[model samples]
Target: MTSRPRTLIAVLVLVGITVSLQQTFVIPLLPHLPTLLHTTPANASWAVTATLIAGAVSIPIVGRLADLWGKRRILLACLAFLIAGSAMTALSASLGWFVAGRALQGIAAGVVSLGISLLRDHLAPHRLASATSVMSTSLGVGASLGIPLSAFLAQYADWRLLFWTAGGLAALAGVLVLLVVPGRSRPPGGRFDPLGALMFSSALVCLFLAVSKGGTWGWTGGVTLGLFAGAAALLVLFGAWELRTAQPLIDLRVSRRPQVLLTNAASLVFGFSMLISSLVFTQLLQMPTAAGYGFSESMFVAGLLQAPGGVCMIAMSPVSAMITVRFGPRAALMAGASVVVCGYGFAALLHTELWQLLVCSALVGSGIGLAYGAMPSLIMSAVPVNQTAAANSLNNLCRSLGTTTASAVTGLLLATMSTTVSGHVVPSRTAFTTVLLTAASAALLALVIAAFIPRRRPATTAGPLLATPTAVQRHEPRPTP
Candidate 1:
């Protein structure tokens, strides 16, 4: 690979990891936030919820804007949000300021999707496959690494240092982009749809709010039902408006394509499957061993156990790319999803051994690396080059939807089926087992979904990928003897 592609991939991957640091970095700090921020536990939980809502709203919007404005330009804006948000969170003493900062940090989640689109705008075809896989898996890498790092920080150092470190890294990423990332000209496109954006944002907030808060707020409560109804009504309106508009925020027509639609569906299922580890494994490791299945480990040690899974994710990126190159992205998706199915299957049956669970987690992480790497490649192959960011962001939104749904379902299951150990209620072994089995089912569904994605059509337009005819010829697949 050329120095430019190598450097660009490194920079974008760094940005991906930096944004994902917020994913689980706050989990260890959550229980203490009530005392630290001088708020009730219920209100303190908003520090987490705010980020979820903001990320759901910001992700697709950022992608659309990047397609309309410029990838590098909007990317800088995202980095700015990260820096400012992290600094705000680090300095905050009150609950309100802290939640606001977290929301900004959530907006930065769009960076990963944006980076994938930016990669398509540069790099050669053969190189794009591996580079994209590495970039897509970087989120897992960061999230995996962040948990232990955050746990250690929360355990020993001041809590504010987490945000400060995140901010410093984001600032460094921004500087690197300024120096290394080549700027793309803003392609001629239709006007930005303000009304469409507002409607879509409102609808998303309603949907996500109901999903995230329903467990705490009461599933059958009037407010939860109201939010769901509101989301449905607004989406109907948003769809109509997008179809009527000259340049819609999301191109509904393209989205209806089987390739796009199926890949997104698979993404949702795969995302749901992936989050099971975060929700179930962490609790399983940290819960009191008296609960029968728990290990009674500290948060830091629990995090250390999961960190190897992140390493596995990074390790599998090249393998994922190789699969995509050899047997199309569809096969790659199915192959990855099947591996995850086995991972969860193993966990469901074997809970007594720590090493067994660690191996299972690593297996799931590797499968996720393989599957996630293929999603962008699949989406980009089917969509127009100009809409790469928007499409990928939409797919990301699907994954977010999956993760959000996973959190609610798993939370409900764990909460509903519980037993008391030493007078304190905890999720029962049956409930824990059910969650793992559910994740396995979701992975199997993803495999079934991937089976339906039409084979990747040969690249019609390499766009910015083709440096010259000679470079294109050099990158073409060689015939096997």
Candidate 2:
């Protein structure tokens, strides 16, 4: 029933803006680089790929650092890094320099993780789940909002202006984080796990490279095979190292807890499934007006159509919180997952019309709004507070991994499958249906996993504490929201 301090909400919004800006700004500019910078499409593609690789590899490392030093401080540092990267990008004339700037921006991608952990640190108990959900959905919101703005600017304004605008936003985010968020508790003399970071980063980089380039490289070709093999080996070694270390980078034992593991698994599957709709819908929307079922809108209009989904997600946050409160995190999650399954089912059945697409999008958006909100609560319920940033980062990483996987598979399927409908080419209906089925199946799987989450016995509503805090929180009752 209590309200969270507005300062914390401000910080979350700033984090979302900064993190989303890094990814969204480059999208509208992707094809232009060939002429703008005299670079090949292949080389320019790295501008996008580098950021993703950096984000995936750096999240856990930066998250661990946030846990060690301070989440707020780390967040500020990331913003600073992002600002510098944007500035470099703005100034760059060569593709290589621009790529370097993007890579730097990628390293700071932990802002979202740090923001989620901070919510658990600062928000009121009754409000935590809802706040977490909004924060999770910010990723979607940022993407939706950024794409159109970036496209408009790239199409009309100077390309460098995009970086300048992003730089200004990053600087503002850094200021807000410093001015608003509270300081973190000093960890108990734990050293940064450099070895663990190296191993994990190496694995993620290799794995990501394989996925990002697999379509171009041929999945079984030398580059993809080598990267995949190397990634698997390093990840296995990283797991072994973590189990042996006195202060492991990630506590595998805690991760194995049902609440932690299943939420993460669900996050991965749902994240991937969600991307299918976005990708498919975008392609469908942009297909020439001559193509039936295609709107053939300009960049701006296409972005606008999808933008409302983010708004829908933000609107659903409060509802999701109420659901979590009334039915527990597991039930809330299962409900959300079920809704997403139904969303995909609707999409599969109703792909022939525009209104049908909009309805499916709304269903999927609302369902994701609920799922995103529930994940943080589930993780915080089972893990230690000091590990929150790291744990949350891991969950985000899973989602990212899922997204990357979905994109790769979708690309492959669309490339291989096609049909001529009324003499106009389009993605094979059969291929698209297969993807919808896959998405629905993933959501159903998440629902099944939600069933196994351990229940916390009922508790009185009067306490400042949660029913029972997680392991780290038991020591100090770390702020729970």
Candidate 3:
């Protein structure tokens, strides 16, 4: 209700927008980066993959850091990373520099986690759900809006303008954060778990590299298999380290709570389902019309066609809050996943017409808006206040895991199930259908998972964290969404 909270929320939303926009800036230029940066296409692909891997590794670490250090301080640090990366990218003259800049930009994705935790710390309990909902979906909103805007800038202007704008906005937002966002809380005596972060980050990088590059390297190839095996090994070590550490990166016991555990499982599923729309639908709209089921649209037009989906996400934020308030976040998540399933089902059946695809996208977007908005509330409902940032970050990591898996699955299916049309290889209708069905199935799986999340209780501060190795955090009253 005060000017301060309102300003803080606005500035953080702006940071979210800036962060999401940075993620997509390089996308429009990927096909041409080989020429632009004088590199091989394979090397150029790292521009995208680097950001993905960086974002995944940093999400959890930054969340824990925010809790241990200070939310506002860590947030400002993330903004600085974004601004520096953006400016570096804008000035990049080689593939190596560009990839490095992109990696730094990826680390800024933690601002979303910090923003949610900040809201929890700064706002009244009654305002928490709606504020967090809006903050969470801001990424989707920026992403949806960014796709077309970046495409336009890359085409019409010096492509460097995209990064320049990104840096400028991030700088403005950082200044606002320093002026408007107030207060910091760090529980005394908790140490930063650098070893835990290193093990986890290494595991994630290997896992993401294996998943993202498997199609190019052959799924059964030695390098791909090695990375997967290495990831599994590192993760086992990471878990053991967390269980033994005095101040672990993630509290494994607290994480094992039914609410937190199941929500994370469903978050991964939802992430897979949500991203399939982005990967599958955009291609369907851009393939040559001679392929018999294609629209032959420019990348910009295709992005424009899907723009409604992002709009629907923002439009549904308040609706998601209302649903969470009335029936609980579990119900909202189920409703959202159900909508995604229905949308994917329709896409599987009736994607022949342009309007039909639009309808499918709108439905999926609305569903994702509802689902994404509710996830934070669900995690917050289960974790101690000190661990809110860390827990939410882990949930986001699960979603990222789902997304990387989805990317692999869709890439694998499309590559294998292809046909040569007019002397050029093209993904067959069967591939598209199968991808849609797989996404729908994932959403359906999330619905099944959501059924088991226990109803929340009245709001109470979460119990003491990290008192001992065998400590039991409160399970009965973290408060339902």
Candidate 4:
């Protein structure tokens, strides 16, 4: 790789890390938000939910806009949102303002997909896999680091300082990107699909709201059921409309390709498997020792224990790239899923010790690194160059949906299956075991789906690219198969 590409990759990775950190930085502060903002816990929860909903809605839109406008322009706009949101959160003294700021921050969630698209546009074909792998791994790295970083800041400093720090980092990323990243490509021209965007966004919000709040609102309650039903109906309509539109927001035709379809299916399951380890292990580590399975570690300690997993993810990026270069992204994905299954199985059997949990987390993180690294390679291989951002965004959206499903299902299980320990109701050992087994099952399913992904022609072979509506051909051969 040239020095300029290296610099561009570094800047994009830093931007990816910054946006990801914003996603989790407020988690440790959730419990205190009610008191700090002088609001009820139910209302305070929106601070988190706002970010999630906004992110889910923004991803595809930003991606489409990037394709319509330019990658760098959209990226700078995302960073602006991040910086402005961080500043707003830092300065806010009320719940409404805080939630609004969080929603703005969520707009930056598409940075990773945009970064991957940017790499595809600018980097050499040989360099694309490694660069995208590193970019993909940045999501895990930022998430893992955000927990401890936030916990420490919440404990030792004014919590608002965390947002200030986020703002500073985002500002730095913007400066670096402005200085080093090259100018934009001529974006394909098309009318903005307002109707399509509206339909998709509304459906996503309804679905996500149901998933995020189903437990708190009672899953059988009118509001929860109504949201789910509305989401389903809207999605069906959205699909119908998209199929007939001339310039659809998401080209269902392209999305239905066997490789694209199966990779997305696998991505959803992989997302579920990834979140299961985090949700289960965090609670297990912090539960009172009297609970039989608890490690009774402090939040910071638990966070630190999981930090090595992020390191493992970063370390696995190059390895994942090498595997993609040698065998194929499909092979790398299946291998990663298999590793995740083993990790979850290990946790199911041997989570009694802190070291065991740490090992399991690291193992799972390694699998996540490998799988995530391969997913974009798979998507980019199948999609046109111009549509790369939108396609990658859809893949990322699938993963988010998976995480949401995992959170809902696991929350329900932990809530219902509990044991009394010193007058406190805690999730029983069986609950943890069940969740782990479920996660393992999801990984096994992903492996199966990955196995069916059609092998691509080797990068050395010159062949016609997969056909799409836009008919944008790849400038280089597909990644090795």
Clash-forming residue pairs, model 2: 128-481, 133-373
Each model's lDDT comes to 0.87, 0.79, 0.85, 0.87
Tell me the tens digit of each residue's lDDT in model 2 across 211-234.
Answer: 988998899999999999999999
lDDT agreement of model 3 with the native: 0.85
Q: Model 1, 1-481: lDDT tens per residue?
A: 2358989999999999999888788988988999999999889878878998999999889999998889999999999999999999999989999999999999998898999988877877778889989999987788888888999999989999999999999999999999988886555455788899999999999999999889989989999999999999999999999888877899887788788899999999898888888778888998898877899999888877888889889988999888888887788889899999999999999977899889898899999899988888888776776678998999988988888899889999999999999999999999989999999999999999889887744444443222233333343333222
Question: What is the C-alpha lDDT profile of model 4 across 1-481, one tens digit per residue?
Answer: 2358988999999999999998879977887999999999989989878988999999999999989898888999999999999999999999989999999999999999999988877887778889999998888788888888888898789999999999999999999988987765466766678999999999999999999899899999999999999999999999999888777799887788788999999998898888887678778888999888898987777667778878888988988998888888888898889999999999999999888998888899899899999999888777777678999999989988888789889989998999999999999999999999999999999999999998883332422222332334643223221
Which of candidates 2 and 4 reaches a greater lDDT? 4
Model 2 stretches with alpha carbons more than 4 Å out: 1-4, 184-188, 419-426, 457-481
The whole-model C-alpha lDDT of candidate 1 against the native structure comes to: 0.87
Candidate 4 deviant stretches above 4 angstroms: 1-3, 457-481
Which scores higher on lDDT, 1 or 2?
1
Q: Over all chains combined, what TM-score does candidate 1 have?
A: 0.94
Once superposed on the true structure, which residue ranges of model 1 sit more than 4 Å away at CA?
Answer: 1-3, 185-189, 458-481
* Candidate 1: 10-residue stretch with minimal lDDT: 463-472
Error of 4 at 215 (Å): 0.8
Q: Give the TM-score of candidate 3.
A: 0.93
Q: CA lDDT of 81 in candidate 2?
A: 81
For residues 113-223, could you state the per-residue lDDT of candidate 3 as single tens digits?
A: 889888887877667777788888887777777877888888889989989999999999989888888754434336788998999999999999999999889889999
In order of appearance, the predictions have TM-scores of: 0.94, 0.91, 0.93, 0.94
Comparing 3 with 4 on lDDT, the higher-scoring candidate is: 4
Clashing pairs in 3: 456-480, 457-480
